[model samples]
Target: MTGSITIALDAMGGDDGPRTVIGGAAIALHRRPDMRFVMFGEEAAVRPLLDAHPEVDKASTFHHCDITVRMDDKPSQALRRGRRHSSMWKAIEAVKTGEADVCVSAGNTGALMAMAKVCLHTLADIDRPAIAAIWPTMRGESVVLDVGATIGADSKLLVDFAVMGGAMVRALYGIERPTVGLLNIGVEEVKGLEEVRAAGRMMREHDMKSIDYRGFVEGDDVGRGTVDVVVTEGFSGNIALKMAEGTARQIGEYLRSAMRRTWMSRLGYLLARSAFEHLREKMDPSNSNGGIFLGLNGIVIKSHGGTDADGFASAVELGYDMVRSSLLQKIVNDLNRFHTSDVPAVPAEQ
Candidate 1:
């Protein structure tokens, strides 16, 4: 529609096969008629879906890829052997070859990450690519990094994560100088290990002056949206992210069911329905679709495992935004900003 913004989708990647993936692609195309998608999966699976819908026939095309990547497969296996047979692998390769601007999948995250890293590589100065999870804040949406990218890292890595993540919040959302926070057990400087403390100090006294390092914030500050970028180790960050999602879902469901229990409650629900819908959508991870694996040379986004058609649709939308935003160029530019020669030695905050 808009010339050609071809998205190579791994139809076999997620829990739902071609059906959900194809349906989601349709939804995305409908939302933006200018975009076209290439469904890469078994031809048998993709053909029927196309034959049934004229919109899909005219607007989208399917590229046959026979193999599907399993959730439990190893990363290397996904690249070498998976490529030999898997559609997801081929879909990723499509991006590398300029066949597609972005690739979307609801498959195994580790395998996807592995294949992407091997093929796309990481940006210079970026150690481990961090998974940036965009969350709802009182101030709007904020992004938390290493949501499951790296397990353990050094202080400098954390600092770099902060830089890339701050850039992400600014690029995706419009936070000019996003506030950065270190996720630690305590708020005091002396509370965390030397690595955490050192990173915090560097951020506080940072010379780049581009980042807004807000001393320290504990886990509770996450949902409240106190900071624009919350940086943490991958293990800790991932757990915190999952817990927050689970809590939001449970609370939303509980409230919805409770409101339907009585006639007066139902009436009240109708009166305050907009508020409930707003809160529910805000808390819904599926609405966010997929998250970008930052610091990578090419665009790589991961959709949740049990995501529905709507969820898959969100991933596609994010992929489009990633391309339009020129995130790869942004990451490279941000990293180059604090390079060895020209950077001013930002003083550590006292």
Candidate 2:
């Protein structure tokens, strides 16, 4: 870990405003004593919360910003209205100016992404940025990219996601040459969209050392942990993410209902209380709360808007890990190598 890592917080961005952000920062500080914070929000709303958490208050330098982006604000509207003054914009600016290593926000996702792109800009050769989420798979955890960052992707963009996701896997999981798979409807070479097929051929031919390109994977393969990184355009990626989350919740509800249906089942639940507790912990969304915005010049983490303090803390820790692992440098190195390598041209789309 670095001797000291500073995180910028959009202190008034989330559903609970300063309460959730401050509490999460306090929790993060507890786990990482070397962490410091630069908080931006309304002074009146944030100061009282800071008073409640002396550890975070002492470690933090607060800046008052009267404006905040609303959750429903469109991306363009946010950019126009909150550009220089809003808490979200200032938080991102801190990263742009090197005032903080990373920025964490549980704010309007659209607004946050917009401000981040405008403030820090995309890295060289990256056409668009992506959001990579740490997914809880049966085998452990996998990195899934383009989870609602943008709506569509071409072959080149898909390749970019693969490289970026591979870098993130290495940073977060210490997996060198992480296996990457393109999420598709089928595993066959000719089974998916032309763009996906083209992307696959490009990856196979280039054979980048940073990632082992597995041909294609179906939706079920994601939870099976068939690959260390799952790459897809944001449209399908976002749908897959939401579906998986809903399924987890649905299954949990079914289990609860089944256990409460009869005295016998309730007794069985009691007999297996420890196992259930472990299962609950494993299924907890809070454990994997942060979605990393990749392919950017700086690190920015977006937490679930409705997540509690613990979940937000998980997001902060994610930023800490990214900085500690030197994620941006790794991505740049991979991109440079991939582009400079002598490789065959991508065949024309059928």
Candidate 3:
């Protein structure tokens, strides 16, 4: 469990660079003493931070990727002209060669996706790789997918996405009998255009192995966690996710400002310190940092661009959880089950 798991971090590809990247790396290593981070970035900046920290066992164990791929680099050009020794590319290569089990990046989303899909390729029988994030709600969290991965997913492709997303929710969160939904404009069964209606109908009738394709869900129902998994094409999913994240930040800032208004309010905040901290930690976007690039041949999690040490730590823990959970094997088993017709309407957990 300790040495068995290796995670590649894109040390040079974040908003804050080494300050936040290495700072967060320290916290991540401190939290999980057993984990090993193969940091890939400018060695000069990264090594000093690792040298200062005694808790991080193998901090010097880094791969120097002198060329950093910027967030604004065009996806196609980045792949065409980007440095061969860049951290992002090396990280993906590590997973491909089995030197690492998972790769985590706070880099360019499009670039990372392209590198992964182009380098690692999609799993057999799977159409495309999708970026999925867990939306926390009253019940727990629901998986939302194609978060800007594929633009125009056909009806059959979305049906495959539903199954893939359902498998992801089950592997990552241990959700058995996970309900699947196709995100649409309206809640009614036949309100959407041909593809949406067709997807809904396929979800109902399609024998999607372990996935219990529940039905269609509306935009507002995503954060509500109405179903275990929400499936949609890349265009709609990305817009909804960005909007939700922006709203969370706005409200969080308001809460902080209101708490600092007066002496009395500040005193009240002190009294409720623990609860406040807990809420803040829970609501922090960094804590929800890891996004699984589902349907890929291997695991790759892309952290947010603004992620700090705490966010990186969360990503590392997620990487560990993914490794320990044996997600790839679970998905493999699911694929086998699908082909052998071992899956029922609600397939039992393996």
Candidate 4:
């Protein structure tokens, strides 16, 4: 792997625009000195921010583009208007041309994914692209895919997510043959949608070396870290992800309210302030901000548009880690190997 990594930024994509994007770049540069950034946006807005952070400015190259893909813009509208000129489009183009190791954007999800698919294209042997997120679990973290790339994945597509997520975990966690689980309603053999069950049986029946398929996993199993990788179709996976985020917020709110209800409780909170701080750090969404678009020829990370500089930094850091891990080449190699083998399907249930 290369010691130095270059990242392209869609400076105009996020809610707070260039300031948020550049601030995040500065924070990430502090952590990774070997990193470089190429910022695409209006020079008038971006240059001053870059100038404020001279260190980041020194490491960054600016490309002026005033056009931006609106947050409400449809995928088709973005493609038509943002084809070659918009900051988001140009940032993705940098990856397609090998100018950057990865592209980081806090943009509209549909627009970003649509542009990425058009620019980077899907890898060989992969039918549809999957979006993978680093889910914070009880056992540290697990990789979950198809978080909302496409809806209604078939059995083979689910298996594809397994392979892709396994490769991602292996790259990030340095684990060989990371355990894989298909997210289901229950762990029973006969439960869940037909596609999930079929995928589970296929993984169980096949002798795939890339991942250790660990059968079915429930929604609760995700945070419990039942497996290193969780595979589900887009619709369910997206809902699960949002629900988890909402649940985390609810728990935090409850904790704060309880801590302030009485003088005695307030004193107790003061005594346990450090522990609470640690818990907050652990639960911070910013610390785990990037959602990766896997199964593409290049790496594309979508950050939460409303997140602050710290959150955006987390996204940039994710992109850096992926580049350092040789993520693209690893996925390509895994797919090539997977396609070469004859993976037979499981028989129909009586």
RMSD of each: 2.8, 1.2, 4.3, 1.0
**1-350: candidate 2 lDDT, tens digit per residue:** 55799999999878888899999998898998999999999999999998888889999999999799999999999999999999999999999898999999999999999999998999998999999999999899999999998887998889989999999999988998999999998787668888889899899888687899988999999999999999999999999999999999999999999999999999999999999999999999999998999988999999999999999999999999899999988999999888788756896655
Q: lDDT tens string, model 4, 1-350? A: 85689999999978998899999999999999999998899999998998899999999889999689999999999999999999999999999998999999999999999999998889887889999999999999999988999999999989988998988998899998999999999788878899999988888878888999989999999999999999999999999999999999999999999999999999999999999999999999999998999988899999998999999999999999988998888788887787788888676775
The sequence of per-residue lDDT tens digits that candidate 1 reaches over residues 1-350 is 13567777888888877777877877887886777776678888878887876686686666776677787788876776775457887777778888888888888998988877877778888778888887877767778988887898778888889888887777787667778998999887668767778787766655654578887889999988899999998999999988987887788789878988999999998999899788777767788878778877677778887888888888888888767666666667777875553543434546
In model 1, state the lDDT of residue 59: 68
Q: Model 1's lDDT to the true fold? A: 0.79
lDDT of each: 0.79, 0.93, 0.79, 0.92
Show model 3 residue runs off by greater than 4 Å.
1-3, 57-60, 256-273, 339-350
- Give, for candidate 2, the lowest lDDT window spanning 10 residues: 341-350
Is candidate 1 or 2 superior in TM-score?
Answer: 2
Worst 10 residues of 4 by lDDT: 341-350
Q: Model 3 over residues 86-111: C-alpha lDDT tens digits?
A: 88888887888888888888888889
Please give the clash total of every predicted structure, in order. Answer: 11, 0, 1, 0
**Colliding pairs, model 4:** none
The TM-score measured for candidate 4 stands at 0.98
Residue pairs in clash, model 2: none
Which TM-score value belongs to model 2? 0.98
Task: Compute the lDDT of residue 263 as modeled in candidate 3.
Answer: 99
